[model samples]
Target: MVNCVVKNWQGEAVGETTLDLPVAKEENAAHIVHRALVRQLANARQGTASTKTRAEVRGGGRKPWRQKGTGRARAGSIRSPLWRGGGVIFGPKPRDYSQKMNRKERRLALRTAFNSRIEDLVVVQDFAAELTSPKTKDLVTALARWDVTLEKRVLLITHEPHETLYLSGRNIANLTMILATNLNIHDLLTVSKIVATDAAIAKIQEVYCD
Candidate 1:
């Protein structure tokens, strides 16, 4: 078990919480989570874009000219790749980007990500820092008080999207916000550190626990 210090709104350490490392240390947690999130992100890709191939393009079925009659070079179809406005060759086609992963695998991946956060000993704090208005300066100032600067990418996880917080952090190049329920492996792997709300941590435990 490892102790995670929790802080209050004023950036003060209010208490400490213990987390079981075993749950986070499953054999392939990282791999599973990475796979799951990769699948999810892949699915989110816009694969609907499609282009016409020579065979699929209109006005391409007939030979452009007689094979031996004209002085012009032989041409198979008007839509040939060599012709202007011709169909594309080996172009992109519409497809479903979604891939499936087992429910257990998804859960494990999520647990692994959470465990990674714990291992990193990311900071968890109360939600009292919610801003009434969107102001990047205020949010930066708040984090500065905790000795967290804008130099590194920070992931701010909350129970839900707080407009004020969202707006405040939107202007800062190094800060990003994400909802707890939508947590993903990339965010965990890429961010310099995580700043999660207490409620978000509880929700994570509830969702990942076996």
Candidate 2:
């Protein structure tokens, strides 16, 4: 459980909010969170990198020189790994990099990781209504009011997608916006600061606190 001060668009503390998601035990918290983080990153890889081996390289069937009596090192196939334009030796091949974890354990890890970042979390009122237009300047000012700076990587979690809010924040290079329902371990842990709307917090609790 955590207690957070809720601020308005002007950065005034108008109220407070609490987060009470179930998390892993302290003894296993770090391990579970590490596993979850690794799984998320690994699953994101495309695993499309591939290379040809000596046996797979074209024109490797013919030997370039005899096994002995050559002035230079006795060369075999022109596609030898030691030569240029040759097949790779023990190179990577395309394959799946995804990792799997139990659903309950993954959720527990997420809860633990999120709870660990309480100190860096900032809760704010739903300010989508405050933005009359898709102005990045307005969003920047509001973020400044919330003590977020352009130098830091920020994660903005909202209850749902708001067109105006999205437009306002899309241009901020360091800002990442995501829905509470789609929360994942990577964004939650990588950001320097987390700015979540009060409604988003409620949504997180509803979706994750089982």
Candidate 3:
């Protein structure tokens, strides 16, 4: 097991803890990580974009001009693709972009993500970082102490919802709060650093560790 420090809200290391080797460590799989990332991005698409086909466009019922004999080229409906306000020939329609990965693959991808960010992962003991009020500046100070710039994206994970923490992160555009239960490979790879509390780490191991 790899040992990592548990830091206080002031960013001082108060103690150390061991990462559950099987859950937090893994053999790197770049391809699998890419695939999982793609799947996640694709799934996030609303896929609600739609366009009118020639058949669906109104005012297309009447033929615009005679089929032949006129100096002008033979014409069909004004809604033809060649004309202005014409319907799209082929366009996006409502669809489901969601993709699925097997359970084993998902677990592997998450573990790989954890391993990739091992150096950037920090575990904070619950009491050391507990917040009773929602203060964005306080959160910023805490992060600055850890060398995690507020300009860069940071993922803050907790075992359970903490009202102050959630609200504090709301004002910080670059900071995001997520529950350990909702943790996925996408956020892990998207952020520059991860700050997870001891409770959150325990929760993640409980859920992901075999």
- Give the clashing residue pairs of candidate 3, or none: none
The C-alpha TM-scores of every prediction are 0.82, 0.94, 0.91
**lDDT (tens digit, per residue) of candidate 2 on 4-116:** 99999999999999999898889999999999999999999999999999888888778887887777788778999998989998899999999999999988988898998
Better of 2 and 3 by TM-score: 2
> Regarding TM-score, does 1 or 3 come out ahead?
3
Candidate 1 C-alpha lDDT tens digits along 108-175: 77667767676444455755456777777778887776557668888888887677777778888988
How well does candidate 2 score on lDDT at residue 160? 87
What are the lDDT figures for the candidates, one per model? 0.75, 0.92, 0.81
Instruction: Give candidate 3's error at residue 54 in angstroms.
Output: 1.0
Cα deviation at 46, candidate 2, in Å, is 1.0
Q: How many residue pairs clash in each candidate?
A: 1, 0, 0
> Highest lDDT, which number?
2
**Model 1 Cα displacement at 89 (Å)?**
3.2
What value does the lDDT take at residue 113 in candidate 2?
86
Full-model lDDT, candidate 1: 0.75
Off by over 4 Å in 2: 66-73
lDDT (10s digit) by residue, model 3, range 1-210:
678899887779898877763542334588787788898899899999999988888888888778877889877899988889998988988999999988777877787778678898978877425677888888888888877886788999888877787777798988888888898888898898899888888887788776
